[model samples]
Target: MATNAEIAGRFEEFADLLEADDVEYKPRAYRRAAEHVRGHPRPIADYVDDGDREAIEDIDGVGEAIADKIVEYVETGEIEELEELRAELPIDIADITRIEGVGPKTAGKLYRELGIETLDDLEEAAEAGEVQEVKGFGPKTEQNILENLEFAREVGQRQLLGEARPLADDVLAFLESVEAVERCEVAGSIRRWQETIGDVDVLVATEDGEAVIDAFRGWDSVDDEIESGPEKASVRVGEIRVDLRVVVPEEFGSALQYFTGSKDHNVSLRNYAIDRGMKLNEYGAFDVSNVEDEVAGQRVGERVAGETEAGMYEALGLEWIPPELRTDRGEIEAAANGELPDLLTREDVRGDLHSHTEWSDGNNTIEEMVDGAAAMGYDYYAVADHAEGPGIVGGMGLSDTEILEQVEQIREVDAASDIAVFAGIEANVDAEGEIDLSDEVIDALDVIVASTHSALDQDAETATDRLVRAIENPAIDVLGHPSGRLLNERSGLDFDATALGRAAAEHDTALEVNSNPRRLDLWGSAVQAAVEAGAPIAINTDAHQPSTLEYMRWGVHTARRGWAEADDVINTWELEKIREFLH
Candidate 1:
């Protein structure tokens, strides 16, 4: 059966193809329906299988036409219209649109003009100076396409954290069910919570390595067994590669430390170990101060630490560093000096400032969103739906009148509910960094999250200026998704963080660490820079649906990676303190 993600993917592809074909209206409808389907709480396929087409159509933005397609996909495992459209265009629409400045319209234009159907074809055209000869194409545009081709290729090789993390969880669950498995952990970049992952790595502590390997190879999700050994195996699951390694229980800690490295961190540690007359490897740390033969193997000397990660670190005269801070970014020195930060955790988040409801592009209504927030134990919640401006799609942004009207509705809900509901707007910051909303509307609101929705390709200086102007606005309390980047998709902006952070500090505006897995903007390094510059950070999920609020964990880990403490994040403050800061 097709999952919500699979069905949503089809609708999104349908929208992309329609847009490329120059078909209007329906594309927006399909895209909106796709978003609704992806965020729907239940399995859409279940509705289709039960012959409940009405139930499926009842979904927000899903019409009879989209309902019929959903049914077709669920029952027949394919949508005929989408297949026909693919046949008509016969190009990699996804790959082509992924280029920085290229959209569906541009892809369609290039295909129609130069018969370009893939990245390879587009690259060939750009290299031959044929793109500039085409109408509306110029030297600068051609250069951008060429420059971004490599990034696009790299993007194709990696999967978004949101998509890959669930698969990792499933793999871990399956491995843990094996009788021979005593301990299991996910390692590498996934463990570090990097926004994009190349593959899933699993390490196991078990005496029966062969039994563990056998059990892993027989799992139902294994699409193909790439390679298998007595102690190790690799399998392809869906579009991701999963590797499993097993060692004896004693060596589990050392093995995990060895595998969960950022290469640079491990290199520094190895040198540190050599300086201490010790050898470190996956097996254990060995004291070799008196050993005459250097190449006598790791087990040739007295064992110091191997049973636990902390023990290994203690053996080296350092504290155990958090996984997120294990990036060789002074974490070693900090650990040695006992000065590693007490990184922020999920519990530190008090409320979410950026969210939406049916009044804008969200699936739920105001009452439902408020109820969800109350259930999450938040003291306050802000409904910062999109305001009328650029990139406000599906006519979903609220006008000044609508925002005023929403303020009344929000007050009514706040009076009736246990949790405080703050009326707010996610006002769009234009290319000039000026908000389109009136000062009156901005001041009347409890919070204003200014974000850049369009003009993402501006050069560094212009982008910095635009953002600094937004920060300087007295009405703007937080800068949402400062860089506007989408993981593995778009490099939204490239401004100097130190400059922007300093300006933000001067203006008393908080920088947002958007928790939406796709846009963990103000990523780790940027968060650190902003915090170092004395600018407060706000970790917001930018949730369009209630369930997405759970993504706060990802944002917290990302912030921790940046070395942010609870006090450095404004959201972690009490409701009164938050309101005081806003005022």
Candidate 2:
């Protein structure tokens, strides 16, 4: 059966194709339906598989037409209408539009005028000066595409952590049920909680390697078998490639440590070990201090540690480093000195201060969203709906009057709610680094998460200055999705993190690590820089619906990757403490 995410992805593609085809109004409707489909708590495919069309349509924003298409998809494993759209364009619309300035409409025009379908075609056209010759495109546009095409192609090869992690969890759950598998854990960049990963790597410990491999091959989500052996196998799951390796129980820890690495980190750690007469590898850590002819083999010396990851670190006289901090950025030294940060965990967060409701583009009402937050055991929640500005379109943004009206409603809901409902607005930052809201509206909001939604192509210096200026504004409490980057899509802004952070710290404005999978902005390195500069951080879901509020998990891991401690994230503070910070 198709997963909710998979079903929603098809509709997203449907919307993209329709927009590329220049179909009016239908694109937004499809996208809205797709959002609700993705955020719906229950499995939409289950209802379709059960032949209950009414149940499928019961989901918000899902009408009868979409219900029929979903049923077709669940039953036949394909939707005829969507397939027709693909056949009509016959272009890699999604990949092509990944270019910085290229949207679906531009993609459709290019396909029609230049017969461009793939990145190769686009690059070829740009290189031959043919793109500039097209009526609407100019030399600058052609150059921009040429400059950004490589980045786009590279992005296509990697999957977002949010998308791949769930699949990894599924694989783990399946492996745990196999009688022959003794132990299993994810490794590689996925284990490190990297923002993006190339593939999923699973390491299992089992005496019966063949049985483990056979059981893995039998998993239902396995889309295709790429290759298999007695102790290892690689398979294609959906679009992702999952590699599994089976080892003896004794080698499981060493294997996991060796695989769950940033190459630089491993190289540094190896040199550090060698300096102490020790050698480390996948098999085990060995003390070669008294051994002669040390180059004989991996087991030339007495084994010091082999069975547990923490023991491996203990043998090195260091603390066990979390996987997220395996970035080789002084983490080894920090661990050796017992100075590694106590990274913030999910439970440390007291509330989410960035969220949306029906006042803007969100699907839920303020009351419904607050109830959802209360159910999640949050002490507070903020309704930061979009304010009228650039990038937010189609009457989706609230005017001054609408914002004040929403604030009143939020307060009314807050009066009866278990959690403190803070009134907020996701105000747009113009090119000049100024929010468009009036002082009255700004004052009324408890939190103002100002973000750059337009003119994202500003140069590094200008972008940094713009962000700093926004930070200097007293009304702006956080700079949300600081770079405006959409993973695998727009490259968004370029800025100096240290400068942005220092300015944020000076002005008491927090930096946000947006939890929306599409935009995990202020990514690990940038977050590190900001935190180092003493800027407060906010890991918010930027959730548009109740189900998406659960996105806080991704945000927490991302913050950990940045080395953020509980005190660094304002959302983790008590209600009174956060209120003081807001003031």
> How close to the true structure is residue 486 of candidate 2, measured as C-alpha lDDT?
90
Top candidate when judged by TM-score against the true structure: 2
| Model 1 / residue 347 / CA error / Å | 1.4
Error of model 1, residue 436, in angstroms? 1.6
- Models 1 onward score TM values of 0.74, 0.75
Q: Which ten residues in a row have the lowest lDDT in candidate 1?
A: 35-44
lDDT, residue 313, candidate 1: 88
User: Candidate 1 lDDT, tens digit per residue, 413-505?
Assistant: 999989879998999999999998876787679999999988988765678889999999888999999878787677687676777789889
131 Cα displacement, candidate 1 (Å): 35
Provide the overall lDDT of each model, using Cα atoms, as 2-decimal numbers: 0.86, 0.87
Candidate 1 lDDT (Cα, 0 to 1) = 0.86
